[model samples]
Target: MKKSLVYLAVGMLIFTICLGSSLITNQAKAAEEYKISVVLKALNSDYWKSVKAGAEAAAEKYGVNLSVIGPNNETQVIQQINLLEDQLVKGVQGLVVAPLRPQAAKTVLEKAVSRDIAVITIDTDADFEGKTSFAGTGNFQAAEKAGKYFADILAGQGKVAIIRGAAGDYIHDQRVDGFMQGIEGTAVEVVSVQPADSSRGKAVNVMQNIIQSYPDVNAVYATNDEMALGAERALKSANQAGVKVMGFDGSPDALKSIRNGELTATVKQDSYGIGYTGVELMVKHLAGETVASEVPVPTFIIDQNNVDASIRDLTKAFSRDRLEVLFGEDVIAEVFAE
Candidate 1:
């Protein structure tokens, strides 16, 4: 009888240990599947869409739930703030944001920090003190490269017109400042500087006015690829010849233009790196790992000399496998069918 009682007690102890271990394993698995959110400036551009694709790829690789949202245009300050509030109220564990304005979203981001949510900034930094870290390219440095190349091509003497993005945007301001610094010692006089609100149509109109006002303008510099392309259209329509055009962002359209001799040159930012690193850094922070406060992806100049190599780099950086998942295989086929 004593032996039988001892055997029964041992069996009960073993069953309890097994049950406790199972519970612990299940709890750990649940904790590992954290929910993260990504807020972009706008989804209207190919650049932001590519960023979304990279973020989705990272979420799939890391087994995290991700929600990406953006306003129709970067100027929609109220709509962006509302979206941030919605995410915060939904109790997201982590957030990655690209602020449209320098100081516009600081208050709302601080509210997220107050609620103990981890915040990461990408593409553009918020002026908020609450952000955990930032992952993006050095816009100022990239613009400086474009400016120096532009100045060198003109032999450092010409009248140049400037078309910039929306006012008060930190990234746009940095690009303008960097370009000014790059051409400081050169004689490339900037005859006019106008804001196009980052719109292709607006840029075209602005370019038209600039050409009329400064008929002797020998070159043009646009802060982004879209504006640059727009300026290209305006120059073509006006039948203006021999005026060099330099742009920022090595977008697909810009690359094709360079190949066809429509655009002079552009600076390429690592869009994929920004998105991929944003998610990776946020995950690391959640896992209690130390991460840098600001992670910068490098940039480079792409001109006729290195356009082919730049194309290869851009194709590899924008993953076809991951993009096929976000966009259907048919869409990818149509886009790259050439």
Candidate 2:
């Protein structure tokens, strides 16, 4: 009877030990699960609005927690850097950032790597050693498309002007470089290129000044939607005739302008796709899947020919909070609320 009692105690002890070990292992696995955080340059512009919608929608679908935040303006690099640090302190498992200033965020990014948080850059890539990958529109190629579109719209010959965003932004600079290269040796003469600081008011002033200087400038290509609109307003105000303006990024205003023919065309950047894909790649990388280090989303130039359908697509893309799942009206209605 004593031996039997001792044996029963030993069996119970072993079972308890095994059960505790299993529980610990499961806890560790659960702790490894990730929550993604997204940081954009700024809010307000339709470009970042679409991006935020994409990231949020993706988070809902993937069963992961997501947080999206950014500065009030893209020009405030220090504020963006501080925001990254704040997210890090909040214990984000992964990050997707459209960096305002690349060099400013380098140290924090390295810190994020040290904490084993996966990092994927979106929209703008900084020169740094810590990013896991980059996923966004290929600005260079998109710019080339814009340039060619300009030439084609003007029938490959005209005096053209350019309005650029920030001075140091990779995406904006690439657009300008690609435009210049694309127009090299072509009959279209690039009349003036100036930095508009991504401000509509600044763009208006710069464009108005340009029109005053070169009254015959036939085309204007602004690197972003806001600047483009400003240039258009200036041109119309000055009563500048035959000057077809093009902008980048499919902003809601840009679409409305397209409908009105005030803006000739724009290189569509799929901001929603950028946001969603950035999160998707970050999650995959965390899962130990090999994703491309650089993903260049495709772009298209929308002229009068494809403007109607393209504008419709742009609206759907913009209404990211309301995407209807294919063949499932119930889910679509439930998810979209419209």
Candidate 3:
């Protein structure tokens, strides 16, 4: 009976050891699940609202935890910085942001990286500071393309005005510079540069001022979609329908206007893909995969010809595959390549 008792004890010991090993393995696997956070400019704009939806969808599909935050506008640098500081305190696995200001956002990136959290920039460039990667429109190149698009639409001989959203923000600045560079030595003369503050009302007021200053203005470029639509309303209110308007950010309003032939063109940014690819890159960094240092998501110039087709086929509401079809695969691929 003593010998039988010894055998039973050994069996019990083996059972406990096996159970403990299984528990440790499960716990370690749980730790491997990646957690991430995404920051945007604001939810006030439909562009960012759709971006949040896409981020959530990607998170659900990938079995990852994602939390999103945004400031009231792209210029809200301090608020965005504070938001990042909070996320850092929470110890997220990765952080993705479209900086309110690239230089200002740099410090936050450095801080997050020092803590070993993967940092990725989306829809903006903060490369002067260290980051694992970035995915955004090649703002400079895209702006250049947009400028040329405007000049071409105007047939290269017309007075044009530029309505910029804000002055110091890198994204808007790069866009303005690109547009200027595109029209360099062209007959299209730049008559004005007005700050729209990215408000629809502000854009309308600025656009009206430009119209008053240059009634002969043949083309206009609003730095963002909302501003562009505002310019269109101003032109329409004055009974001026022939002035070609090119805006950035292919928001739903912009697309619809393009379909209606009001806004001449818009450089469509893949914001949804920005959110999704940003998350995917964060996942890759977390998974120990080698990723590019910068990703340049390309931009699309929308006009009447392609607007209806693109908008009509807006399927899945938000998906990377569908975004590629709407924006183009080269966009997000270029973003990751950086």
- C-alpha root-mean-square deviation, each candidate: 5.6, 7.3, 8.3
What TM-score, over all chains together, does every model reach? 0.86, 0.84, 0.83
lDDT of 2 by residue, 70-185 (tens): 99887888889999998888878899999887777889988888888888999888667767999888888889878877777678789989999888877789989998877776
Worst 10 residues of 3 by lDDT: 309-318
**Candidate 2 regions off by >4 Å?**
1-33, 315-338
TM-score of 1: 0.86
Clashes (backbone N, CA, C under 3 Å), per candidate, total 0, 0, 7
Model 3 TM-score is: 0.83
Candidate models: Cα lDDT each: 0.84, 0.82, 0.81
Any runs in candidate 1 off by more than 4 Å, and if so which? 1-32, 316-338
Cα lDDT tens digits for candidate 1, 113-168: 99999999999987677778999978888888878888899999899998999987
Candidate 1: the clashing residue pairs are: none
Which residue pairs come into collision in candidate 2?
Answer: none
